[model samples]
Target: MLKAKAIRIREPGGPEVLELGEVELSAPGPSQVLVEVAAAGLNRADCLQRRGFYPAPPGVPADVPGLEFAGLVESVGNEVSDWKPGDRVMGIVGGGSMTTRLVTEGAELMSVPAQLSLEEAAAVPEAFLTAYDAVVLQGGLRAGQTVLLHAVASGVGTAGIQIATAVGASSVGTSRSAHKLPRCTGLGLTHAVLVEDGRFADNVLAAVPNGADVILDTIGAAYLSQNIKVIAKQGRLIVIGLMGGVKAELALGALLAKRASIHGSVLRSRSSKEKAELTKSFIDQMLGKLESGELKPIVDEVMEMADVRSAHERMDSNETFGKLVLRW
Candidate 1:
């Protein structure tokens, strides 16, 4: 048996609940690759899962608690191609990411953009791909269009700003802390606000004057009604997460008047087939932007796998800007 160190949910609760343990696993199955993980990205879903909110897929391990990783291939099962031992890559997984090694189907990966270090690539796949899908693919973002990103300093939010700029679109980002707003400015964010400072709608409207052509919101129900009021005619609003709460009341009148559309997406619950398609599409469409440094992943901190409890605290508290990584 091969044994690896992993972070597990001792029980659903706070940061204190994550336990560092050893787990046994079999070798990769056909069409799968075993990656020797260098680092794993901590996502909000990990926090949610740890809180007993996000359910584990059937047959998937319940304890392991991370969504994505970047590493070198250690082995490849039969029928795999486009990868071999020692290849550098980053990819998403159903779970079990915070470990020394992970098993992923062959189609779930892409070669890492050459210049990115494992440390940085840890921030790539989940946040960047999710942002790319929301801002570029689904929203049909085009040059001169305006985008509004809630949680400007977050991993997905920052990625949206850089990618929007890379695509020649403009972006406005909002954060709850005014102090964190400046950190996002260098990425070409047009306007940034502290939700505590004033009304986000007013700040957004003032910045664009014409209202947002696209809005990427994670705040969910909390911002649902307000987003409808400011979205431009024929605009697209893509909601990726609902940190605030899920249930929302809507004003259909405003939605009808503006001719805006709202979309909700969850990457984790999607089938393996859908995820493979998303990963490949992202590699094709977003690779150039990453290669040119037009789009970048922001990494706030990296800590030892042993310190996962503390890492979870920082993520759950939402004190940091960008991705938090755990190194093995």
Candidate 2:
């Protein structure tokens, strides 16, 4: 067994409840790899987990809250042949990623692009995978199409903007912070809409006229009706987070008239096999862009792991323009 230092949630409450602690890890089983984590990305989901709203999936440490990590492979299980000690890797996990060491399936790992540092790589897996899976794979975004992304300065939103641009599609992004919109525009966002009082459908229409071919939404129920109003005929709306609210009346008439579809996605709750498939798809489709600098993780800041509480507070307050990476 190996001992690892990690951030633990003392209880269901605020950032003050977080503390540093130690956990034990067994040797990697066959097909698994042990990693020395360099850094981990801080997501809003981590904040939710700390507040007792999101629980880690079964088999993961319920008290440890992290969803993505970047690290150096320390050892590979006997049956694992694709990686060796010292290889730089990054990927998503169900939880328990904010630690000095972790064990996971080798198949889940992606090589850290030579163009990116480990801290930058820590911000890649979760945001890029979520955006690629939601925007390209499920949304079926095509060349000449337009995608409307809510929370446009978020990690996923920034990644979505670049993905849309890389695929020859245009992107219109929304944000309550006008200061952040210019960064999104510099990242290839074709249009920026400053949403005021949750009213953006008219502005979205004004930008695209015909409406968006795809809408990647993180603010769930609160934006449902407006999403329906802004969707183009046969548009696909992919909902990946419920930051706004969970319960709202759906406008069935508007949905039916537009012939649109809505998909709710969560990466952490997925089965290992399903996540591996998604990782493979992302690597095949998007990894080269990351390697070539065509697409990059837009990291808002990197902080020491000891400052995790502040990181969580920043995310909860919606002050970050992109991802926050925490390193031990």
**Which has the greatest TM-score?**
2
lDDT of 1 by residue, 209-289 (tens): 788898999989999887887899999999998888889999999899888999988787678899999988988888777
Give each model's whole-structure lDDT.
0.87, 0.95
Candidate number achieving the greatest lDDT relative to the actual structure: 2
The lowest-lDDT stretch of 10 consecutive residues in candidate 2 is 263-272
Q: C-alpha displacement of 168 in model 1, angstroms? A: 0.7
List runs of model 1 lying over 4 Å from the truth.
none
**Could you tell me how far off, in angstroms, the CA of residue 26 lies in candidate 2 after the best superposition?**
1.3
Give me the displacement of residue 144 in model 2, in angstroms: 0.7
Off by over 4 Å in 2: none
Error of 1 at 186 (Å): 0.9
